[model samples]
Target: MTVLNNTLTFRRGLTLKNRVIMSPMTTKMSFFDGVVTQDELNYYSLRSGEVGAVITAAANVQDGGKGWEGELSVASDKFIPSLSRLASTIKRNGTKAILQLFHAGRMTDSKVLRGVQPVSASAIAAERPDAETPRELTEDEIYHLIEDFKKATERAIKAGFDGVELHGANTYVIQQFFSPHSNRREDQWGGSLEKRFNFINQLVDGVISVVDNSNVQNFIIGYRFSPEEYEEPGIKMADTIYLVDKLADKELDYLHISLGDFKRVSVSEEYKEKSIMQYVHEKINGRLPLIGVGDVRTKEDAENTLANAELVAVGRSLIIDPHWTSKVLEGKEDTIRRVLADQDREELMIGNGMVEFLDFMMPERLR
Candidate 1:
């Protein structure tokens, strides 16, 4: 029998023990102020020993970037100790930790920011029915936000994290700037594809400067991107390929690929059963280590994706079964639980609070 071990290494010198990586799952379990909680610690630790790396839920980089009530935050130094503890717990359990730094952009609820409007490429509102309309960022504000990302990267390093993944997908601030439908500005940050890419370039440059220094060489810098906007027609695969090529020289350790926007929960279901990374892998051709995510639930799916890509990312599957990766590696495929469509939909739409809902939605064995 062929042993299906899913370990993979990248040119950047970071080696994942298995191809199964836990994709960032938003639990909304953090405190209202974004402090890490014991529940989150335990939840992540349970799966840490099973996967290669655990990318945490998005941690907002600035106060203005705070989008949801329970989302994690790294905007302040005071949050460092707690974040450091979380990182240590995951690493102690044998999985590398990567903090996902994000800016909610227009998707942020206005209530959380205390009446301050969310910022994005233009004064466009998120397509999500529940999202608030956002204020367009001024030229100066956009430049300042770039610096904020750099500072956040520095903070992640200070928190003893192994790496940081930029949340550029799911219609976040970076994604807003990338999509022409959202970024209709007539300025340097908006007109052509090159200009649309300028924000991401500056963001990567700023973060790399802080993360790739001699002292921080071991820190992996990665990006989570969705080239297609789901329902929006403007952003295409070619744009994403161009963006990937642009960042190929930035010393990125990995690329995590996910499809659809945060506002479009419906499209997420389509990606839930497929590996979007396979397409991205073929496009990049191993230019950098690729992390394939989307609807991977079984050992067979993980092995197939890893054979073609560098890594496989599991989200809902891990939430339902923490030891999923270990079971797959040990050739106990039958032990792997099957996730239902409704449960997957609930998780993606309701975020972290859907765990209890999932228990009710799935059979006892699957749950």
Candidate 2:
């Protein structure tokens, strides 16, 4: 079998049947109470059994962490039952289900938060024109938040998921703690780069402790990160290299980089010759597997990405074609959907909320 078709085993013994993963994307299809709804179960069910694994939409770890309307919640025991159904839907077809954990930090507005001001490592606001400055998290609050993550992981294991992925990208709390623009604290959690990483250091350690005791066999734990930031004094490739180096040493099953284009080059001209994933793979140096994702629309795209990273995740492509991996592997790549239409919804099992989000965010994809 080819590299993309071969089963790859991780450090902890969990193995993927293939290299294609369904990258986590928000669906806004859950219930208002943060419970997994039938719509969500159906949506994921349609896409499963084709890919090696599915990293689900971000599940907020606390009530205050909800980033958008209809987001999933693993913050409490009450959510576990529905979460179990969601997990089984994906895993029943022999695909691994990984629940992604996240906290929005300052990315959300007070209106979405229901009058609660968003919190971050520091009080600084994002550089976006309409971004609101978040309230600074107290030292005690920081510890509590880390516990929230651990608890969420515990819940994931309870839900019978194959693993959990820390949503460390997309300007969320984890990225906020690492980004210079977002985290400006003078305490041990901020200031120097090493100090700024303290939160993640403690977070991974705490989570590993939970998994260790749970005895959940072959349970995988992964971290996803954005390689470079565009903000002033933001995280750059060099900084990401250092960060990846440190994370790779932490016994993680894999490290996934969040990027829009799988073949995108470095934002800084200094490293323009190589793609960001290539640079990160170099830094990783076989310490751990890396998952590369973004705009991977074809069999060739996934194949090429696998050259640099051990696994390839596709979000938009899978959205347009639910059976993408199967089609490619079956030598029916010509039948793959590169774009979508209103009439194809039933065939692809597309959900209404998914169509709306894609329309507003990427209208061109819909013919």
Candidate 3:
């Protein structure tokens, strides 16, 4: 067996049976009201057991933060029982379950928020076509939002999840606050690089405070971030390195770098010599465990990723083959599905909503 099967333990005492992790992918299978549904449970049940941990799709921390129609929510106590079932389903056969928390920020339109104007650190519209200018969040609103994240963590703990991943990547509310292109405010929450970091710094502290006070033991807290942004004045590699340095000091369990290709170098004019993984890993310098993911489909790919990251996260590969890890563990890698076919949808437990989403975001994957 390759080193991919090796076990890993976090500083906080959470141990994984192996280095494989199921990266969180939006299934859009939850109820319209954001409650976990049976379809969602079945999807996780089929994929959870073989991996070390499964990070569920982004769940909005507040009602106004909802990004899509079928996304999950941990904003209130009413979701605990449903979320409990989800955590139990994923924890089968020694697998760890982590719920991802996020808010869409300006990424969502008024329609998604039921006519409520989307909020962000600054009143700016995203660069995308037809993007609506979001209302700037007030100081009181920002503090309340941090409290919302804390309450979400409490809900995750009560639901028996092994951890919670703050979705600070992909231009979400957290990333929006950190991105100069998105955050143009002059308040304490914006302006200088350190000021922009105020939102996530406080958010992480609030969430960690919940874990510190919770009765649960070894409840992990991880942060996911995109290493670079495309827009000028956006998050450059230097900015991300600074963020990594700051995060290293925080008591986080892991840092999951979001990338399209694990081997990708900096897209910015500067820092193009090494892969994003190598750069981030160098900055981390063994201070925290990192989860690396991007187009990891084969055993060799995962093993290679292990060279840089503490854990390897497989997303599309697992969606194409629910038993991807099991097959790898059993020496059946030759039989694993490489491309997703239309006819395999039912057996794959892929919902219609997810199918539609994949069609839009990753059309080339579906054949």
The candidate that achieves the highest lDDT relative to the unseen native structure = 3
Off by over 4 Å in 2: none
Candidate 1 stretches greater than 4 Å from native? 1-6, 231-233, 260-278, 339-352, 355-367
- What would you estimate as the lDDT of candidate 2? 0.90
Clashing pairs in 3: none
| Predicted candidate 2 versus true structure: per-residue lDDT over 1-367, tens digit per residue | 5677889888778888888899999898888879999888988998999899999999999888888888999999999999999999998557999999999999888887889999999999887778888999999999999999999999999999999999999989999999998989888999999998999999998998899888789899999999889989899988888899999999789999998888999988888999998989988999988999877888888988988899999888888888888998888988987878888876766667676677764668756
Model 3 TM-score on a 0 to 1 scale: 0.98
What overall lDDT goes with each candidate model?
A: 0.76, 0.90, 0.92
lDDT by residue (1-367, candidate 3, tens digit) is 7777788888778999999999999999999999999999999999988999999999999988998899999999999999999999999999999999999999998998999999988898999998999999999999999999999999999999999999999999999999999999898999999999999999998888889877788789999999888887899999999999999889999999998788998877678888889989999999999999998988888988888999999998899888899888788999998788788888888989898767765678757
The TM-scores, one per candidate, come to 0.87, 0.97, 0.98
lDDT of 1: 0.76
> Largest TM-score belongs to which candidate?
3
Ranked by lDDT, the better of candidates 1 and 2 is: 2
lDDT of 1 by residue, 284-310 (tens): 776787776656767666666566567
Poorest stretch of ten by lDDT in candidate 1: 259-268
- Pairing residues by index, what is the TM-score of model 1? 0.87
By lDDT, rank the candidates, best first. Answer: 3, 2, 1
